[model samples]
Target chain A: MRGAVLHAPGDVRVEQLEDPRVVEPTDAVVRASATCVCGSDLWPYRGINEVTEPTPIGHEYCGIVEEVGSDVTTVRPGQFVIVPFIASDGTCAHCRAGYQSACAHRVGVTGAQAELLRVPHADGTLVATPEVPSAELLPSLLTLSDVMATGWFAAVAAGVQPGMTVAVVGDGAVGLLGVLSAAQLGAERIIAMSRHEPRQRLATGFGATDIVTERGDEGVARIRDLTDGVGADAVLECVGTGESMDQAIRSTRPGGGVGFVGVPHGVEITGRQLFSTMVRLHGGPAPVRRFLPDLIDRVWSGTIDPGRVFDLTLPLDQAAEGYRAMDERRAVKALLTP
Target chain B: MRGAVLHAPGDVRVEQLEDPRVVEPTDAVVRASATCVCGSDLWPYRGINEVTEPTPIGHEYCGIVEEVGSDVTTVRPGQFVIVPFIASDGTCAHCRAGYQSACAHRVGVTGAQAELLRVPHADGTLVATPEVPSAELLPSLLTLSDVMATGWFAAVAAGVQPGMTVAVVGDGAVGLLGVLSAAQLGAERIIAMSRHEPRQRLATGFGATDIVTERGDEGVARIRDLTDGVGADAVLECVGTGESMDQAIRSTRPGGGVGFVGVPHGVEITGRQLFSTMVRLHGGPAPVRRFLPDLIDRVWSGTIDPGRVFDLTLPLDQAAEGYRAMDERRAVKALLTP
Candidate 1:
């Protein structure tokens, strides 16, 4: 099997690796159909996070289940499925409470940028669609495994409602998808904060009612101006830097909500500002499994085409080019076919 | 008229001040029958907050309406009423959404600890009782003006549910009242974190199912141990400090909600920790006006006695003693009569 591996910071390669097998009773072997480079992948690729050795490097994919362990029940061999990045035992108390990301028995599926990947807790982690989706819908359904579901979680956490104003602070695939999620949730106005032309176009296509090409304080000011000087009813922070968090906080109306989905770097929220502004903060690793089933359906039905984010594509052997394109900001998202 | 004035930090006195008069067409002047010192008042008196000049102090009171401006239609002269600390016009979109504290035309009622106080937006800010209450119930009903209502907001914001566990971080009058609020909201397990004997007794009387005297990490450990290592379903943070904020965050279950009511001081929330934990943070100034009607009824019916928090009482002229006792930690709360 061939997979993308990171040997060190700034060193990524697609090379032959040992094929994955179902090592546990609840595991399933997935033959990857399509995978993509994530914004989060840039963290280790850019040397911001330490890479000790050659490690499997992908967590998003839509694939066909090639094999399943004895305990797997919901998904069977040969079924096309969307696998949530976080695998959970779905019956755990946390999973029952709709927090599958924090499931008591959870495993993270890494190295999906490969020909085959092992998925743990298969019954709870994989959402099987009625059939194998068309090639055109494959990329979008793949996104439902992570980015799209994450965007949906951000919108849900922020409590986006009909006739409400929502601001999204990050221009990546997840942030662009957030506009779609907010629209689906009935938000009347969706503000996309971005300066990139491709991302701006994608955001608009995904139902952004407005766009502010500013950053930080300037961006917040623009949102407030658009909201009649009262900031947005809900803000989705998809970039995890201090500036992004600050903009998200400042862009929210008093008594509003800020839902953050970005893996934070060094941001911190002051108590005084948090209480004085009276904004509710809710976010974290999204419960992607909770939305996988419905999102896959939406993608299959052509209700949403999140694959539009993939402006670049390559074969699995050229995974390095996919990562480089995203890292250099040359593409919104890069799709890799294994 | 006489009012409690803070000449500077540590110097509170009952002194003559100009009699309050209606300044807005929708304003109403009320003659205070009773006013109480709030836990927040001691922030300046204890030198935590700098007092620049003779600031009119206090924000909790129950009184008889002395006069109503021409535009005041809901509340009238001769009516007994409880004034919410925040005066909202009740007509703004925010107020219509039940967030009266963030009302578009909201104003703070200063000098509530006075013989007479001018309340702005009287129609929406003051809730009148059916009849004048007896002397014994006056103290409890007066609490509905701020602390009691604030505590109720904490419980509501935390989404305390029947059979769920709740942890309160502060043991002040508001925190003690938070226990009662949680009980009223049907939280089955209310854990009040307190080291002081008096506060512990008060918390237990207010329906605290357990008490933990440890602070910070130790307190979090105790809470986790009690909840079988999962932490509380809801946490009410009534103390606004870095330590209290950390404790609240650490004590909540993943995906649980933390409702903070304390005016934040130097606390900060890291985006990474918040996202990883999947906790929901919600709070701000209590929309006390929204809960005034029901709280007044609860007090009048003797279903709740928030006045039990007032361990000490003095005449209006002895305002200095009231401040000193609270500042020195001798009393949880102090009541004053004119």
Candidate 2:
């Protein structure tokens, strides 16, 4: 098998690796149909996160099951499925409560940017589609593995309701999909914060009612102006920086909510500010397993096409190009066909 | 008129003050029937919070309306009413959305421990009872002004539901009342965390199914053990310290909720911690005015006896002794009569 490995910062290489096999009774091997470079992947590539050793790196993938262990029941060979990044036992209390990321016995699936990958807790982590999907449906189906589901989680956590005016802070893939999720959830209006023309267009395509290009305090003022000085009813913080978090909180109405899905970095929130605003705060590494089935169904039905977030594509042997394109801002996301 | 003033930390005196009158069209003057020393008041009385000047102190009161300005409508002269500690206009966007504490025009009534108080936003901040109550009902009625209402807000914010297990982190007056509030809200099992004998007895009397005397890590471990290793479904954080906040978060199951109503001091929360927990955090100063009507009715009907939290009674001239008793933990609460 061939896979992408990081030997050092900014040094990703496509190299030959041993094929994965079902080592545990609950494990299964999946042949990668499509995978992508995640924004989080850039953290290590930029030397901000440590890469202690050469390691196989991707956690998002959707593909056909190649083999299943004796204990597997729900999915079988030749079936297409979406894999939640965090694998879990479906019977755990946290999993039962729709928070699989915090499941009592959980495993993280990595090395997905390869021709084949082994998945633990197969029966619990993989959601099989009704049938094999067409080639054109692969990108959208692949997104259900992480980014799209995370965006959907943010919208749900924010309490996006019918007739709500929602504001999304961040112009990345997650933010764009958040606009789509809010639209599907029946938000009356969506304010997308972005200065880039292309991302703004993508946001509008995803049903953003308005776009505010300003950043920080000026951006908050713009949202307030648009909402008649009342601020948004729900705000999605898709960037983990201190400034974005502050802007998101300040742009929400006094009794509104802020659902943040960004992996927070260098952000500190004082209890006084949170208490005075009375805004509900909910976020985390998304429990993608909980929302997988429904999201896959939506993608299969063409209700939303989140695959548009993938602006670049490459062959499995050229995986390094995928990372470089995303790192240089030349691509919103890069899809790799294995 | 006479009121309590803080000459310095640990120095409270009953002194002559100018009589209060309805100065604004939206104001009203009330002759206080009962005012009490609060757990929050002890912050300054103990010298932990600075007392830069001889400030008039107390924020909770229930009284008879003696005069009303021309614009006052809902509450009139000669009516018995519960005046929430924070006065709000009741018509602002926040007030309309059930967050009166964040109302655009809000005033904190700090001189309630006096013979008379001039309350602004009279029509919005005061909830008039159906009729004047007997002396025996005054204590409970006065509680509707702050502590009881604040406790009820904690329970509601924590999302307490029938058949759910709830845990309270503090055992102060508000914490005791929180137990009562959770019981009223239909929580099947209530766990009160306290070491004091009297407070534990009161908690059990208020419907606490279990009492854990442990604090911090051990306390969280005990709660998890009691909940089948999943932690409580809802945790009310009544103390604002970092340790209390951390315990409250760790004691909640993933996807659970925490309602913290303590006046936050020196509490700092990192976004990473909050994001990783996936716990819903809702809290702040209680919007007592929003719950005043229902709580007043509950007290009037004898359905609840929150006033039992006040274990000491003092005449207006002995206000210093009232503060001293609370500061020394000799009394759970001090009720004053003019």
Candidate 3:
């Protein structure tokens, strides 16, 4: 099997690797239909997060099940499935509470940017589509594995309600999708903060009622102005940087909520700061597994077109280019055909 | 009129002062029926909070409206009222949204221990009881001014629900009342963390099903053991110190909530910590005004007895002794009658 590996900072290569197999009773081997480069993937690629060794990369994928272990019951071979970024037992307390990302016995899916990937806890982590979705549905379906579901979780965690004024920070795929999620949640208005014209256009298409190109203090002020100095009722922090988190918190009204889904890099919040604002804070690595079924439905029904976030595509052999495109800011997200 | 003044740290004195009169057209002068020493009062009395001058002290009070400014309509002369610690214009966006403590045009009430007190935003800051209550009901009713209401806010912000496991992390007046609040909210099991025997007894009486005397990591571990290692569904942080806040955050289950009502003193939380735990954080000064009417009914109906937290009662002239008892930890709380 051919798979992508991170050899060093700024170096990704597609090379021949040992084929994956169902090694555990709860495991399954999935033949990748589609995968993508995640923004988080850039951390190590950019020399920020440590690259300890040539590691298996990518956690997002949609695939067709090739083989299932003897203990597998919920799913079997030949079915199309969305592989959630985090694998859970489904019966754990956290999983039962709809926070599968914090599942007691959790496994992270990797090497998804390959022809075949072994998935642990298959019965609990893989959500089979109603039927084998067509090739065109792959991009959107694959996103249910992480980014899109994460955006939806941000909205849910922020407590975005109908008639709410929501603000979203960051212009990456997750933030753009957050605009879409807030819209789907019936937010009356969405203020997308972006400095790039293309991303602003995408945000608009995702149902952003307004776009503010300013950032930091100016960005918060713009949102406050738009909301009549009350700040947004809900703000989604899609970027994990300290600046983005601070902006999101400041742009929310008292008693409002800030749902932060970005993996934090250098964020530090004082208790006094949070207490003074009277804002609700809730977020983390999204429990994407919980939203896979419903999001797949939305994509299947054409209620949303999250696949549009994939502005670039590459063949499996050209996986390095996918990382380069996203790293150099040339693509919002890059879809890989396996 | 006579009011208590903090001449300096550890030096409180009841001294003669000019009578308070209706100042703002929206203000009212209340003849004090009762006021009390709050947990926060100890902060200044113990020299933790700077006291540069002889400042009027006390922010909690319940009394009869002696006079009302022309614009004061909701509360009027001769009406018995509960004055929330913070005064807010009910029409502000925050107040309308039930966050009166964050009201746009807010005022902090001071010198409530005086014979007469002037309250701004009378219509918004005061909740008049159904009628003049009997003498024995004063303590419980006075608690609606701050401690009891603050505790209720803690439980509410933590999202306590019927049948959920709740934990209260402070044995002060507010923490004891938090146990009562959790019970009133229908939590199936309430854990009170306290080392003090009297406080534990009071906590149990307030519907705490369990008591854990451990502190820090040991305390969190005990809570986890009590909840079958899942941690409490909702944890109320009634102590503001960094250690207490961290303990509260650590004791909550993933996807659970921590409602911190204690004013944070030196609390610092890194984003990585919050991201890893997936704990929801929400809190601030209690918006006591918002819960006044409902709490008053509970007090009036004998549904709750928050006044039990006050272990000492003193005449208004002995306000200094009230401060002394509380500062020395000799009394859980002190009630002062004019």
CAPRI classification of candidate 2: high
Mark the regions of model 3 whose C-alpha exceeds 4 Å error after superposition: none
Q: Which number leads on TM-score? A: 3
What is the lDDT for A161 in model 1? 91
Predicted complexes: DockQ each = 0.77, 0.84, 0.89
User: Candidate 1 regions off by >4 Å?
Assistant: none
User: Taking the tens digit of each residue's C-alpha lDDT, what string does model 1 give over B1-338?
Assistant: 99999988888888899998988898899999999899899889888999888899999989899999999899888999999999899988678767899888889866888899999889988999989888898889888888999999889888798989999999999899999999998999999999999999999999998999999889999999999888899999998888998999889988899999999888888887798888999888999988987888888787898889999999989988998998889989999999
Clashes of 2: 0
Chain A TM-score of each candidate structure, as shown: 0.99, 0.99, 0.99
lDDT of the structure predicted as candidate 3? 0.94
List, residue by residue over A1-338, the lDDT tens digit for candidate 2: 99999889999998999999999999999999999888888888888889999999899999999999999999999999898888988989999999999889998888888999899999989999999999999999999999999899999989899999999999889999999999999999999999989999999999999999999989999998998888899999998899999999999987688999988988898888888888888899899999987898798899989999999999988889989988888889999998
> Best-fitting candidate, measured by lDDT?
3
Question: Could you tell which candidate, 1 or 3, scores higher by TM-score?
Answer: 3
Across A1-338, the per-residue lDDT of candidate 1 in tens digits comes to 99999988778899999999999999999998999999999999999989988898999988999999998899899899888899999998788888999888888879989999899999988999999877888888888888998899999998899998999999999999999999998999999999988788889999998989999778878997998777899999988899998899999987788988999999988887877777889999989988877787787778888888889989989988888899999988899998
Worst 10 residues of 2 chain A by lDDT: A39-48
Which number leads on DockQ? 3
After best superposition, candidate 2 residue B59: deviation in angstroms?
0.5
What is candidate 2's lDDT per residue for B92-160, written digit by digit as tens? 888998999988899988988999999999998999999999999999999999999999999998889
